[model samples]
Target: MAPNRREKGNTVSDSDPHFSGGGVAADGFDRFGTLPDCLLVSILSLLPIEDAVRTSVLSTRWRRLWTLAPLRLLDDSALRSEKFPNKKLLAFRAFHDEEQWRTQEGWRVRAIDGVLSAHAGPIRSCRLSRVYFHIPLLDGWIQTLSQKGVQDLAILIPMEKRFYLVHPSLIACQSLQSLELCYCRILKPTQPRPNLVNLRVLNLKRSLVTDAAINDLLSCCPALQSLALVHCAGLRRIHLRSPTLCIMMLDDYSWEVEELFVVDAPNLEHLMLGKNTTRRTHVKVLNAPKLELLGFLDMSIKMLQLGSTTCFEKSMVTLSTVVHSLKKLAIRVDFNDDLQADIVFDLLRCFPCLETLDVLIADMDDDDEPDVEYWKQQVSLDCLDHHLKSVTLKGFLGQRTDSGFVNFLIAKARVLKVMTLISVHAWKEGWVETVQQGLCLQNKASIDATVVFMKEKHEINQFQPWSSLF
Candidate 1:
């Protein structure tokens, strides 16, 4: 036996008789290792991410092959596995202790740095979640990623902890396309502000995004298409005037948002608001002719202005404010009184040609009774009479109040093709049959209409939370 030596992060045996002069015996068993560099790199790229990285241990030649493929790095998900109730309680306690959480996540951040040091471009994406770091380290990492041509990047800080300031290098990155930040804050760019010309998608959740920060960023993102702001604070007024933006979502209830006024958006299609039932922002649209999909419109908006028409406290449809261009509409309703139910009718009248209606029902007490006369006084609107084809009701509890609303919709939607009742809080065994018989779904106005039922306590709709639309 002879000694084995290490060289340049690789292992080699100088005393092995079977290996010599960069060539192995023709009849040897090392068939795959004999392949060319291009083929070897391609093969390594096909393997799973971890498997591909482990191949670097094979030989000196193989060590650098993993670096040639695209880089997708992650040091995320510190508590993703602790989803059980007992585990969640334990995690909830630890999560609130900032120091302990930071200490535990320190190793993952170190590993992220190690991988970046060892890997080569082009880095496709990098995701860092639940890992807090000192400002300097995170700034350095962002610079490194920009240099490596990172296209998609996400950094999610833990909730209830202090937020990090976004580094300027990230915005100045020439090759970056998508950026998602959570629990962070953005400073208004200084003199000679950098432009994110190539950026396309921007999603900010639970961040301290000031109006100045957002407006400045919006001006620089000439190519942005999708924008979502979820529960973000410090935005008093959001005014967008873009030619390329197509999808925009606003879920922030931060009292700062006084008004969302879109002055000009030539290509805008989806303008989704929040599902908040308590407060509403005055949304005034001056120009968005291409707007086709609008969702989760709360009944009590401060002032809904589409073009010149002012939507106010009235619960009646006015011809001037009709949004006939809207193809799909989603709304949030209280369903407690005729007043609240009339607001829905008014909304339907405003969108005479709506094809899809997705309604989110507010949670109500079981013992409470609803004013059924206001619902009885409800006449079929143009949408329900001729245009509406699909109806999706979320949070149906099969209560007496629920039966009235469901039956009203079932009877009036003459063209309704499908009605989905997502029962999130119904516990009774025969609740489904009860809702069916009580609502008289089989006698729905639309002769060929189909009914769909779902138990959705654990699974939400695909386009819910209003953030996913963008």
Candidate 2:
């Protein structure tokens, strides 16, 4: 049998407001009134657009509340579905008769037009996702938004059958602060945007903008603080004039790195240059005053003109001036063993004040590993910075060069605390023993630093492993 419970209109406790000792009134739910408009808007803004719009049907109080909150404009073409409605699609195709097709197309255009026009006010953020439109409609909407003053705009122009072009009026946004354009095809050359003075961050990732267009865009964004260009293929020589830009990330390796001139960037802190899939034919130099952090892979001989007298001479001249003031340095070597060692020495000598060094060796061929005693005596690690505290050698396979560098670090870096050796290939049987010999020779009395011999990236091996080496 079920225990006895309170029935409708019955209350047990008088102390609690919810429980009216003897009997409770049905009107108890009507105690709270509408919240402040600002608070309600904040709550609604956190909801998804579909759910936010659903608030309009909630009650009389919420009818127009959603419109008062922030609006996120979405394009219909950006939507993706797992399955298609075959029946509905067939029905739509059947309406290819002139009048019906015209009617359907007209309604579709009008719906989108209405959505965009409705939110033509002071918007906090606007996202135009994969939207395609003719010049007239695009211009009209952008001009309207510019007049209304939008703060953030994210335009992701996808490459598809439909023609998508950026309207010149969009760049004239007076109140725009943050703008992102991804995967956009440049249909025509655009006039630089001088009016977007308040723009803080500009990201053009995988954009079809030409080098000239990039320069023009950078010229307009004088107050931009952070700039990112990933696979913007046309960008060659970058000339940054923004005194406010402190952080930069350029990830296109195909473009010849022209001299980067950062003018009056007092606050510039970090600069990251990623690998170029295609070789950079020309030498690139960076000039910045306050740039303390730099992340760039050392260019290979093939990437450089190192083999030739002209390229080697050029590298020798530039490498000295590259990291003169840098406090931390990272060098990635991918070349012949003898050439790599020589370059490594030359590169290390550049960073006089380098405190931390991360060295990665890639594509070590089978023939590169020679007789241990013979190669060990030949390989040398000299002129390492005294201030170097941490050394990391990635893609380590216990080669003489690898052991030689470790041995050098163990001897030279007096203040060294940690040394890490990561093997991309499988762990050699005696790899640990060889590493231990280097560490033991460094006066076993000195602080025994942490040395890690790790074997990762084995699954990435394409060919059969060489069993003799292991």
Candidate 3:
């Protein structure tokens, strides 16, 4: 081979003889090498950073393509290997092999740092999951990203470590449109807060953030549309006052949230509230005119105040204005003998225009069967008469109360097309057949109505059950 050489900065062009077939030939052609740089860079961007960088060795044309591509850095240990251990084994490994743990941690840090340092363009997104790094290194990387005008950033530390307080520069990034922080802490800014004018989505999971800090952050993001806070610590009372917020989810499995208040959110559309237990929390939804989807799961709230005059006490209540805009509603509650049917009826009455309803029955050991008499006392609602179309009931036990509630829906919901009942407990001999026969015999208001019965083994075994409704 006579000195195969090219000038510095000379990239392989489509017309190059070597690329066209003089020297390079794959499957009798060099189609890949002839592709445009932008298209190649897009292909590289989808691969993991490590894999993307390795492509640099393929050819001179590919050497610098990855650096120009939008950077997507993900440090997920679970994706590191196919045989990754379970949580218990991971905990054991973290405690037993200190040296190996440190070595792996250092390798991940260097890998991420090496890529961020070499890349010269704006990063599209960066996600670091279950990775621990030195505070200075993390701060420097965040500062670099801020300066580079990163659009999306996610920093998820390992659950075993203490909450890592994010750097100030990260919060001040004007280019950020979406941000997610898990197992971290959002510190109170010292001086004037930076207005994240473009931020639309914000998710904080298992974080340690005070109510004041969160409220202040929301105030700064005037254009925020979606916000999710899951199992956050030090958040007893959350007052959301965003005017532009459209979707919000609050999942405090620890049951630490004592009070939740939403005010002046005119554009609010979807709201999800979840708690692990049936804890008594105060929730108020006010001034949300465009609200459509509402989910209140795993809690028997003490009071749910909707607007000014409408409120739900221990039983339930209705807000005509609030429910008029609601199209979908989901709720999970423990079965109370005296209040189960009343609660369901009150909820249905509140949302006169609701089309979809999902009910997840929390398993309680007590034998407090659902109150079947309350079904007869149910006042006619527009939802049951005209609007309600779909009903999904999980954890159905086929008890008298459960069967009666189903029977009432079959007879009352004039527009209901589907009723899904998944049994949480194991079926006794001929129980499923009997329940199906009883539901079918009931005079359904809608002639097109169909009943679906599914046996959820995991629900009965006390394991988490998956729902196909969502």
Candidate 4:
């Protein structure tokens, strides 16, 4: 027996018209079906196009609900299931395997296009990466979306390697708050006044666009809050000067980028640079007073300039310059040789006000310790004594070089509160004892410090809070 639920209009009994063996609602009846139409439509809008359309078969009440909801389509491409190191390589191979994937892709495109045509409500978001990016088809779809008022749009084709000039409809979509494009090209704006004033987030990865195009885009996007250019080609120099921007990530590892200069970004906060993938020789932050999080600074940077005066060149590694605005920093270093201790210590000295330090270690074949004297000769850094509170060492294997750096931190960082050691799953038997001996935790300088050892990547992502922005 079940209880009868009463509403202003009617009552819901156990005999509700739900198929047998279906999910039991909270009230043991069709309570979910009683939610207001607006909420139900909103829920439907978030689902994949296929799943959203399937809801119509439930009953007459849900038959037309999908048409009243926003349409959202994504690129659930088969190739994306496997994590390829390089996306450009996938694009090159797509041509050879075109016939094998054509049949499935053709069906997918037709279904998406039909759904777009059938939708009677607003178009909130669309990501057409898996489908063929024929210019005429894309323009037609975008024309419909512009009329339906799409807010977020991502037109990415991983199989496209050559540059195709983005249709003017993409830039003219006045309703867009976020725009992301990959494997396409954006030419210099020909319009007298391009209309992307409402866009708040823009990400262009693995695309081809000139500096003039970038400058024009930025000039038009007065409300953009976040911007990312990852592995983009044709950028020789970058000088950011934005008033509304807050977060900017520039990863120029795929090609040679000569310089990156942050001329003026008054409200800027997070800045993510390239790691080992970078050949960016010179980096300078002329004015970004609100900057807090900065990461993956290449250890081999040729020139680093901050504010007006102090310049630290790779020619003089012994000298240091401070960046007081940056609270969190990430550095990439490798220990192929027996000695990486000197450079690490010197680099840490440059950030006196750093509160959290993330050290990314590259895996090397050799694990033997030839000399540990280089670690002992280094003097204590200002960050180690007072400011540094947390340290995260990624790819920790407890090698002599790894241990030496951990030992240096444990012995020097007097105000340290937490130290997380992330193992890359390379530890052998008796690893606990080996780490204990290697780190010398018993002789820690900061009595309040606590150490945590994590082996999984899922746990590591929790600390990376801003990864979702890009």
Show how many residue pairs clash in every candidate, following the order shown.
0, 1, 0, 0
- Over 4 Å off in model 1, which ranges? 1-31, 45-50, 76-107, 130-132, 159-161, 314-318, 363-371, 375-378, 397-402, 429-435, 440-443, 453-470
RMSD vs true structure, all candidates: 5.8, 9.5, 5.1, 7.7
TM-score for each candidate, following the candidate numbering: 0.81, 0.70, 0.84, 0.77
- Which residue ranges in model 4 land beyond 4 Å of their true spot? 1-43, 51-65, 73-103, 131-135, 277-279, 308-313, 316-321, 334-343, 362-371, 397-402, 423-426, 452-470
User: Across residues 248-313, which tens digit of lDDT does each residue of candidate 1 receive?
Assistant: 988745556888888899899998877652246778788888888987676655567776566565
Question: Please, what are the lDDT tens digits per residue for candidate 4 over residues 1-470?
Answer: 44564544556543455421224465555555557779988988888766777788655567788899977654434223122323653564566577645654565666667777888859887777764545557778878888899998887865453566677877888999998888888877897456898999999988887788888888888998999987788877778888988998877444666777888898899988767433355777888888888877655556666654333433333354466778898776665444344445655766788899988777654755556555666778888888999998877877776777788889899999999888856345677666776677888899999888877465457346433321
In order, candidate lDDTs are 0.73, 0.56, 0.72, 0.72
For candidate 3, report its TM-score: 0.84
Q: Could you give candidate 2's per-residue lDDT for residues 1-470 as a string of tens digits?
A: 22223545553332233432223346653221334657777776666555666666644556666667765544444222223232553476575675654454445445446655765355666666533333345557667667767778776654552334566666677688988877664433446444668889888766766656656666677788888776665555566666678887776433554544454455666665553321343433344656655545454533432112122421444443544455555555653456556556666665566667766566666677533343234322222425666677767766565666666666566667787777754456776775676554644212755676667565553211111111
Off by over 4 Å in 3: 1-23, 26-39, 59-61, 76-96, 275-278, 297-299, 309-322, 334-336, 364-371, 426-429, 457-470
Candidate 1 has what TM-score? 0.81
lDDT per residue for candidate 3 within 1-470, as digits (tens), equals 22243434445553454462224453444666567788878887888777777787665666788888887655545334223333653775657677776666666677677778888767878877754555567789888888877888888877777688888887778899999998888766665476678899999988998878888889889889999887788887888899899998876463688878887899999887663322466778878888888876443557777775344445555445435899888777655555645556666767789998877776644666555566656656798898889888878877666676777888888999988887745356777787776664458889989888777765343212223112
The all-Cα superposition gives candidate 2 an RMSD in Å to the true structure of 9.5
Worst 10 residues of 3 by lDDT: 461-470
Between candidates 2 and 3, the TM-score winner: 3
lDDT of 2 at 266: 58
